[model samples]
Target: MFSNTPISANHFLIKQLPQATAFIDKNFKVVFVSDKWVEEFNLSTRDIINEHIQDLVGISSKQWENNILRCFKGKRTENFQENYTSIDRETRWLKWNILPWYNENESVIGAIVQAEDITAQISKEQKLEQVQFILKETNEIGKIGHWKYNQSQDIFSSCPMINNLLEIEEDSKLTLDEYIEFYKIGYNRNTLSMAIFSAMENKQSWNEKLEVLTAKGNQRWVNVSGKPLYCNGKYIGIIGIVQDITDYVIKEHQTKSNEHLLKTLINNIPLHIYIKDTQSKKLLANRSELDHCGISNEADIIGKDDFDIYDKELAQKYRDEDLEVMISQTPMINKELSQENSDGTTNYFLSSKIPLKGPNGETTGLVGITMDISDIKQKEKDLRNLIKVSSEQNKKLLNFAHIISHNLRSHSANFSMLLEFLIEEKEEAERQKIFGMLTDSSNNLMETLHTLNDIVTINSESTTNKKEVYLNKQVHKTLKHLNPLLEENNATVITAIPLGTSLQVIPSYLDNMLIQIISNSIKYKKPNVRPEIKLSLSYVQNYTVLSIEDNGIGLDMKKYGEKLFGMYKTFHEHNDAKGLGLYIVKNQIEAMNGKINAQSQVNVGTTINLYFNEEN
Candidate 1:
């Protein structure tokens, strides 16, 4: 890829600049990348040209993507310093600018990016922000000036500009002793001497921004640079420039303070902000996140992770996402996580996590922010359920209409036939048989009406006042209530509902569903087989599961299972099998936000599984 191309010679003045730079087409395909860009990223021209920039380099945040998009639109963005992890996995604070490159026709062709690593400078500034701010505000007095200090004479003097900047006498013959006193003690005195000495000894240039006490006893912040001056190749003096840069210093101070202000703001905000050190896996969480974990605001989170305070499953999930962010060195934005609420509901949050980098372009840690989107997610969930409920109700309504019309018509026809037989029959026995048939038809119609009424009642009331319905207690109550019927059938009931299996459901509805299911097992037992039923309860994910198994004369599931929960559908030859028990059980389950299913095989056994929403 680097084969004999004019650009391969590194024959551009832009290559001579210290900054790392590269140019890429609208497709993010590299066209011309400077040597410094290749060197800084530790890449070769063969690896860069025609390769997607992001594939060969590392950057985080959509802001970088937005900048590139803007450049594609022929706009220019400049001077935003951010810490980035390079392709070589080193972290550096880069100050960068991206501009649209123009073609011969003056149309935008591609984007040119330039960046300088300013990690060392920013790191030093941060460590000394407070002290530097104090010194600058208290002691800044000079403007741009020039001065000379003779090493042999141990003398210091300056022009009018320097004297004015220091607010001193222009003709004052300042000796090295007098000049030394002008530098405030500590860093100012020590640092200034070191810079000057280093410059003189090495015959090189040196610069420092420091504070000084003037001849008039007023303090000042100054930018001073010294160059070794030689006479016939022997060092004689140092020539220097002195400029008051107090305005720029104050601005820099404010800019640094904004970071602290940002931290304070984040702590107070409702959104949860979390940061974790990758090496230690220790979290630094804001007040909202701390509060979520039931921790006091004053408690330190520096050595803790999600696993330290959250549920194991939830913590594991979060830990995985944290690793994903750190590994990709990318932002995972607007991801959803749902947590159970104390009130037996669910609350969802949208979170974003991105890798945080250190000064040397290393992925040191990651930061994330999560905002509660419970209201929105709840609305979405409700909408989905409503749509499902609406469709189900529509189908049920059509089925109801068809069944009611056909069954009522059949009963009416039976009434007419029985009345006609009673009126026309000459024999008393035939009239008696017609009367019995009429009574049976009337009872059947009433049973269907009762089942329809139950369904209608359940469908009308959409709200449920749910509480913690303990499974073991409810199951025992159901079994105890039907003990007499079980005794008649010589049924043996076995239960293995371990402690603490509970659900969020309406008290009556929970009892009704269990009773209907458990009673069915006993009611439909195999003859001479000594009926045995097993009831087991457990918790999985966020649901409480209750399963009932019965060894009985099971029906052809393929023919009957589809309509097992439908109104007035029965497969067994039992006097009480109006087919409404399973229907009522299904409705009760759904009323409490639960689900039901059955599995059966002829002459073997049947198992019914019910899942209820567990209380959180």
Candidate 2:
């Protein structure tokens, strides 16, 4: 009954506490032990309760007792980190929190000791510290920097790499302004300023390449990226990383300079230079093309295709030619092409196109050079025409020689026969008539010689002599020169000319050509109607077209078309119609590398079209 009392029950219940609790007497003996202590040590509570403290725990007896005695001497201590070897000989770290206890009279009795296992936490912290040291060392070796700016404090903090990158001492302090001042001139400062402003005002991030002057007075290129930090929609500051890229920057600049030098060399040449994209039909043309096409501004023609600036047929022809060059993967030289402009002007070109190959030896696009050859083409045409004219003249001269020889032989024969007849018959009238026939035949031979001399003179003049002549003024002058004849024929002349229509031609030949046409129009006036002649001139394509139409007794072209321009062959019986006018007109036009064609009907009218090449 005494053991089962409430006091004993209370003592048993107190002994069942979850923690390791114990009561030690003045002799340092364990007087009471909780169930937790017994279970943790694998000892019976009754057995440990009566054991001495030094014997219960298997640590060094002196060190263990000293720690317990020190706690009981009115001293309090907590978390004295220590290591203990477990039963398995594995070392474990522990923290001991020991507190001294006392009675109400403040006399020290014993202590409460709490031990916490801290091995895992301590090992984790050690590994993390090692990793951080490695990262710092790597940043220093790589010359990379991490930086942060605090707007609230208006301060900047940088890692060791930043100090090394700027060639500043390790202990040096740097501000944002000082950092900005390190940037080299031009884009560096501007880019940095823009980036900072954007982050501050617009909350934008930026990545840029910049040039900076280090403290050692050397210029360096760096790639920098800055991002703004925000907390609760409030702007904090910016953090950024910078990498040294000076070698890459220098290489890139050199490459760009080389490209520009190549482009300049290409542009300086006389050829029309152009570049095309491989996948797209985009083109970049040089200055030569702009000038050749009469374009004043580069923007006006940039990014435009051939169809945008040239005639439809001509553009299609250009595309087809380019496509062939691209597909064949062959370089073409001196390829002849004709291009018509938006104004209907045609240009002859000798072009060369070379495929632009890529690193894989595949055709990427094409580079082309075109040389204007209108002059060359015209010269070739003139040479051919000269050959034709020479052959025709040679034929005519041979025919004239035969006719002269035959005439001379016939005349001598006839003279001999006449003399024999005169001597035999002795008729005075018949002899005199025979002599007169002989004289007439001699005069005809003399006239043929004079005509031949004139033909030679006409053929001897040079064709290429050119001089600037105003068309309107030349027309007026020609009309004035033929005013008397025009007035005599009762002709009404009408003229329609736009201003500033000037041309490059041989002035004398042009005047002669105009005079002949105008005079012929008047000379062939109809019987009943007063001759009305209209003269007009305008530019068409690259050539100037001059038209002369007359209300006259026109010819039946079907009957005499082939002989219209035959030398010394007259169509009309007019005294001035030596047939040489049209012949000379045709020759002069041909010599000047121009063209002339006539349209006529029996009773309607005649119109002659003259086309002249434009001057460069």
Number of the top candidate by TM-score?
1
Compared with the true structure, what per-residue lDDT tens digits does model 1 show for residues 1-616? Answer: 4445334465476566667888788898888777888887778655777888878776655878889889999888865888988766788888878888776677887788887788999988887997867655444344567778888887787766667656788787666556656778999889878878887788789888888787677777888888998889988989888887767787888988997898889889999887789853556788898887778863567788878777889888888988888888888998887889778988788989989998987888888889998877778989999999889878878987897788889889989888988888999888888888989999988976777787778756454577876777888888889889888888898888888776677778778877787777777878889888998876678777788899988768899889988877888777887777888788777766677888999989899888886542
Candidate 1, residue 167: lDDT: 72
Which ten residues in a row are the worst by lDDT in model 2?
1-10
Error at 511, model 1, angstroms:
2.5
Every candidate's CA RMSD: 30.1, 17.5
Task: Give the per-residue Cα lDDT of candidate 2 at 474.
Answer: 92
**Stretches of candidate 1 above 4 Å error?**
1-385, 420-429
Candidate 2 root-mean-square deviation in Å: 17.5
